[model samples]
Target: MPDRLAPLTEALLAAARKAGAEAADAMAIDGRSVSVDVRGGALEQADRSEGTEIGLRVLIGRRQACVSASDISARTMAEMAERAVAMAREAPEDATIGLAEPADLARAWDLALLDLADPAPEPGAAELQDDARRAEAAALAVSGISQCQAASASYSRQRVFIAATNGFAGGYSRTSRSTSAVAIAGEGLAMERDWAAESRTYQSDLPSAEEIGRLAGERAAERLGARKPKTGAYPVVFDERIASGLVGHLLAAINGSAIVRGSSWLRDAMGAQVLPRGLSIYENPHRPRISSSRPFDAEGLPTAPRDIVRDGTLKSWTLDLGTARKLGLKSTGSAARGASSPPAPSISNIALTQGDHSRAQLIEAMGTGLVVTSMIGAAINPTTGDYSRGASGFWVENGRISHPVNECTLAGNLRDMLMRITPANDARGHLSHVVPSLLVEGLTLAGA
Candidate 1:
């Protein structure tokens, strides 16, 4: 398609300069998506969308403003630039507002090696509907599954281009295929539901829709007849499915934006031990086929592998240009931006070191506690790291699962929880966040 998005970004930059912008950056994204959902073993919904979006950021001295639109006409481009320049003129000055210097821009990349876009033909809506219907049928086949809530299959392809006045220009495309299902067990007031989903860059890599549905059904069946456990201080094992959330909190604490605001628990933890002694967290943006992989950040900076936490110690803050400048540190090339916003720090393709033991082994090691499969809500104190969340899972006694439990609260200090975590070797490799199941000690569980 004659390089559709690049020309749009180039035209946007040209318009910005014509509109009296001292400097500017532009991004254009073109995307198409299709989804099919099935309910009661029949097609319930089918949707498709195709569009192009353009964004412009113009700077006047130290002030900057951003504008975005779905219209790609020349007239809209000019109007967007004019409005952006006018807004910049009225905006408050920020010393950190500026594009990367020419020398700092990514000079080259190997998109072929990344394999982000699958070469295979897109699946048709009819094919997707069949997949969803098969998933629903499989869920219903499970022994104790009362109903299949919904089953879906979807595909998306997006092309993105970024250009700046500082001579940085690049574009890349990505594709994803996904299948998901939700299953319910029991009925009425005693009902319980669970879900399973899988996504991949190449459709060939995705699991069969029937497999996902069966997993969902089995999990929901396992949750039947759940009740509350006794309140006490006990060890807790976070399942691999939800363990990434715990690591995400640590990532957020080290975000330069959070650090700059002095609102993070790890604000003063630089070079200090944050995770357990043998654990480390690594960010690698070049991982092939991973959804978060990118060769360059939003500001045109080249991305590379780095250790966010090494040997349990806090190593580096996630940062973009603005936050790095505010912190008096160098950018980690971790910037991400949407069509309507400016660049901000964000991590991609992070992995926590896995342990030698499996998830079942960790469960055995915990003796008596909870194996938290799912959680809801939170009351976290960001500054102090005090954490409380509603949780549901199976209760363990003498290192064996006794029964399912729900409507309970798990409370602990994140700082301490992370420090004592024991990782299990059960992380899925295809995921962007390769965090394994984690066992934490001395948490207060409130139940009936």
Candidate 2:
């Protein structure tokens, strides 16, 4: 544990014991991040920040309460712990609230999640500016490219620690870098802008500046003149980037805390078929080269790979210790927490199984369809599986993207969408929710 976190953790535990609490936990996080935005091929904004926070939780005979602060001194911790215990004492007691049992804690796996060493010096401001400029410049250099909207680069690092009275203690750190560009092509009212982004755990993993720029340039150039498609139901294909939203929706629906509160649509659907027969989903905390991979959860519980959905059947609900006890189920080591909040259930790396059809093949099979590239607006009701979102993309005709389309809405029930899932073989590992292009029939598209 970091020297700054250890004493605070001990003080919190002692305070909880003195307050007649059964168990307690504390977590601390310190992080730094920088972002730079370029517009019109010039630097538009640059920002850098760093901060640390501490949180304390106490369980007083089944009633739990939490408090957090950015301060790390002994006096501050003692005050926070005192406040937490006082709040717990006055709160309504819940029989299902408690920490993981000693036996359960003993079963945790040992995994390394953090890289303790300092991150390498990121690309300097000049280098980052050059990278962004180079990307946009390349885009503009492409034939038919006319203008640019924005280009940017960002880097960030985080370190976190969790400690509990029941002998759970852990911490880890990681870094991230990203570069992106957006460019417009053509002129007059027919102009179109397209964008591309590349993110990586290490800077070295990022695609070359030329590659990212060329992709953006080509995408914009290809959409020089576009038109609306005939309004009607059609098979829809979601590119991998946009398709990841479905995975995010699944995570929200299977959250253990939501299940316990009757807020999740999947509350009673475990073990039932939730998707196509060949589809499966798993949460793998140990997967390499993924941003969300971790050795242990936010509550210091050892994490392991587990099937969230198997062969289209819902296998389990993600759980934290509190919710697990309430539901009479075991925790899946999915607990996550911010520095100032209690542990909540969340997925680490959600990996969807790929199928045997390439993106092009899937498009070819569709014959006439809409290929969604981006989504707008938040229009999902996780509690009921209802979803509708504004989308922009290209229209495919006879196995080819015929025109760019905008001002369209895609509406459907999530449950029904999952059941209609037909994946293509164009899976890419660019996002945390790695997924292949998805094809679904009969989606309602509201547009001309």
Candidate 3:
């Protein structure tokens, strides 16, 4: 921990104690990031940023309050602490709100979470510009690729530290690298554009510039001369990348805040069948190659693999300390935190169990249906499970992909969709939610 930050934490803790606080904690984060963008084979924009912030939390009797600041001076820390205590004093008391007891802290897991010594790569401006230019140029060289909208690369590094009055202190750091390219195909009145993006925990995992460009070009070229399909109900196939978004939606509905506020459709549905048989979903904080892996959760709760849904049945709801206390249930160790905010429930590396059928079998099983490649715009109602989203993809005919479809909307209730899930073996683990290509029996698609 940085000496400057440690003193700030100490000051906040001291202020809380002086104000008669029962518990207190502070968290700080320092991070830096850079981005580069290229268009028409030219560097268009480049930027870099660095930031640091601290957050303080205090508990007075049964009330709790929190405050945050970018200023880390002793005076600022004391003022933030006083603000937290005063706010706690003014707020209505809640019987279940308090910090985790020292005894509740988990034995430290010797995970290599922080790579502090990893040398930050000095990716030169010329190198970034060249990378983006080469990617865009490669996309333009591909057959059937007529134009490139944009290409870019980004690198970022972040460090975080947490200190609590209950003798819990820890910090970790990670780095990320990403590359992406977008291309448009066809000409005149029929133009289609698509993009491909790749990210990894370390810079070494990034795909070569040529590979990324080729993928983007191929995706766009395939969408050339797209047409709209007839409106009807049919089986739908979701690509792994897009399917992960659906999983994220479901996870949001199962968060502790949603459950406690009665805003989630899954509320009170634990231990009940929520999806089709043979379907399962779980959060694995220890999963390798995932950016969100952690030994402990944001609230200092020990994290372990937990099944959220098993064999079509709801198993548990994600919980933070407050929600767990309120519900009289043990904390699920799913807490997540931002730089200057109280901890909230969040799943890490959600994985959906794959089935026996292969990708070919799954696609073949869809005799005549929409093969959704992308979902555009948000149209999910978490509280009601109602969903409608703009979609784009190719049409499957006679168990084979025919041509791309455009200007379509897929509408369905998530509850009904879950019940109709039939998983395939094409599960991909690149994203946080590793799900297979899913086949839903029937969905309403509106198209011209």
TM-score of each: 0.99, 0.92, 0.94
| Tens-digit per-residue lDDT, 116-148, candidate 1 | 999999899999998898888888889888999
Runs in model 3 deviating more than 4 A are 1-7, 113-122
Q: Which candidate model has the greater TM-score, 2 or 3?
A: 3
- By descending TM-score, how would the candidates be arranged? 1, 3, 2
The best-first sequence of candidates by lDDT reads: 1, 3, 2
Number of colliding residue pairs in model 1: 0
lDDT for each candidate structure: 0.94, 0.80, 0.82
Worst 10 residues of 2 by lDDT: 109-118
TM-score comparison, 1 vs 2, better candidate? 1
Candidate 1 — worst ten consecutive residues by lDDT sum? 1-10
**In terms of lDDT, which candidate is stronger, 1 or 3?**
1
Error of 3 at 254 (Å): 1.7
| Residue 156 of model 2, lDDT score | 84
Give one digit per residue, the lDDT tens place, for model 2 in 30-98: 888888887777888888888888888888887889888887777887788778888988999889777
TM-score of 3: 0.94
Q: What is the lDDT of residue 442 in candidate 3?
A: 89
Q: Least lDDT summed over 10 consecutive residues: which range in candidate 3?
A: 111-120
